[model samples]
Target: MESFTESLNRLKEVHENEVRGLQNKLLELDSERCRDAQRVEELCTKNHQLREQQKALKENVRVLENRLRAGLCDRCMVTQELARKKQQEFENSLLQSLQHVFILTNELNRLQGENEKLKEEVKRLQGPRLKPQCREGASDPPSPLLLPSPGARKAIKEKTLEGQEEAQDDHPEKSTGHRTSPVAKISPSANLPETRAPDVSPQRISNQLHGTIAVVRPGSQACSPDQGPPNGTP
Candidate 1:
């Protein structure tokens, strides 16, 4: 009986030591699990911050795109308006030029009609006429001077003087008299005289020519040729 009691006490001690070692291993495993959970939480917080930064960057990019689109639209509108204004200005200039051309055409036609009438009058005046009266022989009446009418004679004399003045104006060295009057510089268009024949003698023709010249040249103090001959003349 004594031997059996001693064997039972040794078996209880071995079972108690095995239970204490298993309890120590379970406590170490629980501590390692707590450390792994803390590391996972820190990683999640970093991921959330990265996502917020990405969203903000996307918003900024959208705002820049909108501003660029609006600017492009404004620029296109300005360019179109400038083009329209330029087109309008060009049309106005073309209209004014056309009006000017029309006015010039009318003036040219009126001048052409006047020139034709003057040519017809000149042809009529140049026709043949009766011979002059001579005193049996006075060198055939000095060849029957082809005298023009009073008005026509004045016009011819004026035209001749104008041509002389133009010649002098062209060559300053040939001009010996004073400057011509502004009226004397009238264009040939302004000098077109009325067509009419008048009874005129040679002396009368000379006088009328002299009068027309006096209109062009002012302050004439010279004596007329009909006033009197030189003292020695008969």
Candidate 2:
């Protein structure tokens, strides 16, 4: 009975040691769980702070964008107003220039009409005396020998000399060539008075009257037969 009591006491001591070791392990696990809970709470707080900062940054950016758009619109309106003012000034200047040109054109037309009237008045003043002279010239007989140009007179003289030479050649005994040349020379000298006379003809008188009619204004009177001659003519 004493040995059995001693064995029961040893078993009781081993069981008590195992119970103490299990109690210590349970205490260590409870301390580790408390530290993990504190770390999880700190992470949640930091995430909430970061989300609040992002919201503030987005609101500030939107305000700045709105201000920038308003500034650009104001500048555009100012530039368009300036362009419209310049266009108005250019149109006003063009209108003034056109008005000045129109006034100058009217002045030029008035001066041209006055100049034409002055020319016609001058022609009328010189027309009356010219008509009487032309009428007197038209009454004279026409003569081919009374040519106005020196070249025509010279050519006619040459033809007359050639005819005289031919006649002298046909009648050689009637006159010597040397004597006939002196007669031809004397004949020109005798006709010098007639050559010096005025070259008056109906054609020349008609041409002068036509020129006077063309120069005289339509308002002037026509020439009359009863009109007196000029002081220079008979």
Candidate 3:
């Protein structure tokens, strides 16, 4: 009976130790589960934050895209309007140029006609005239002396006066039929359509509107000393 009691006490001690170890393992497992739960909660919080950030980012991207599209559309409209205005201006300029060219061409044709008429008149006047005796010797009966019509005489006198005036205006000196000064010749380039003088370069077009004339200011030097001799020199 004493041996059996001792063996029972030993068995009790082993069973108690096994129970304590199991309890400790259970506690450890509980702690590990708590840690895992905390980690999961942290991951969930991070995911929520990330989702919020993504939502904000998407909203910002949408806003930026809208603004960009609006800006692009506005810019396109501005560009189109500018192009339209430029095209209108160009067309208006072209129209004005055509009108100017037409006027110049008409003037040129009229002048050319006048020049041809003057040349024919000059050729007729230069030809030899028949003497009175030579007309008498002709076998054909003499025609009546046909005096120039009053209107014809008046027209001739007017033309002569106009020519004299023009000559005087051109040469300010005793009229020699020969041209003393160089004739003002228009260059072929001058016949081109004229445009509004570029605002930045007015001098390039100055010669087109006004013939070449030497402009001198009050204190400026003259082109030739001969034209502006010493104060008392003849």
Candidate 4:
């Protein structure tokens, strides 16, 4: 009977210990549930803040798109205006250039016609003076005889002065060889020395006389005093 009573006490102590363990386990589960609920509340707040930020970002994108469209339209209009202005300026410049070209062409044509007229006039003027060879538009160098020598002008002046002095000594009352002075006076050529012309043959002279004339100076023809007839004679 004492052994049975001791076994029953031992079983009663085990049941109390088991009951305390179950109460401690219940307290731990309640603490874990509270921590999970607090965590869920914090996550819900974070999700609401993220949704507000997404809406703000969407509104900002809409504003930026509207500004970009307005800017593009303004740029296109400016480009069109610039293109029109440039085209107008180019047309004005081209028109002015064409006018200048027309004016220059007219001037050039007038000058060419004038030049041709002048050349024809020169030919017409030269027709009468041209030689047979020259009539064909051929030309010869000028003859050395046509151009005076360097000393020729000086010699001609000296001779002219001497002739004038001799011509002034016309004495009507003077007598020569007991005969009275004739009405005809001694020519100025009497003061000059006797000179024969160049020995060119008559054939050569006739040949060279073509298309040219021979010239003799006035007051140069004179008769020698010895060859003069007596005064009052025929």
For all candidates in order, the CA lDDT equals 0.55, 0.54, 0.56, 0.53
lDDT of 3 by residue, 1-234 (tens): 999999999999999999999999999999999999999999999999999999999998888789787776557779989999999999999999999999999999999999999999987876545565456556555344334345433433453454445555754333324331111222322122322222212222223222212221222232321132235332
lDDT for model 1: 0.55
Per-prediction TM-score, please? 0.27, 0.32, 0.30, 0.28
Sequence-dependent TM-score of model 3: 0.30
Candidate 2 lDDT, 21-112, residue by residue in tens: 88888887777777777777887887788888888889977876886876755567789899999999999999999999999999999999
**Tens-place lDDT digits, model 4, residues 1-234:** 899989999998998899989989988888888888888888888888888998999998887788687775556779989999999999999999999999999999999999999999999987777766564543543333342233433444444454345445632222233331121122232233332222223322232222111112222233332332225232
Clash pairs (backbone) in predicted model 4:
none
Error of 3 at 135 (Å): 89
Q: Which candidate number maximizes lDDT? A: 3
Best TM-score goes to which candidate?
Answer: 2
Count of steric clashes across candidates, in order: 0, 0, 0, 0
| Superposed model 4: Cα runs more than 4 Å off | 1-72, 132-234
Q: Could you tell me the lDDT of residue 142 within candidate 3?
A: 35
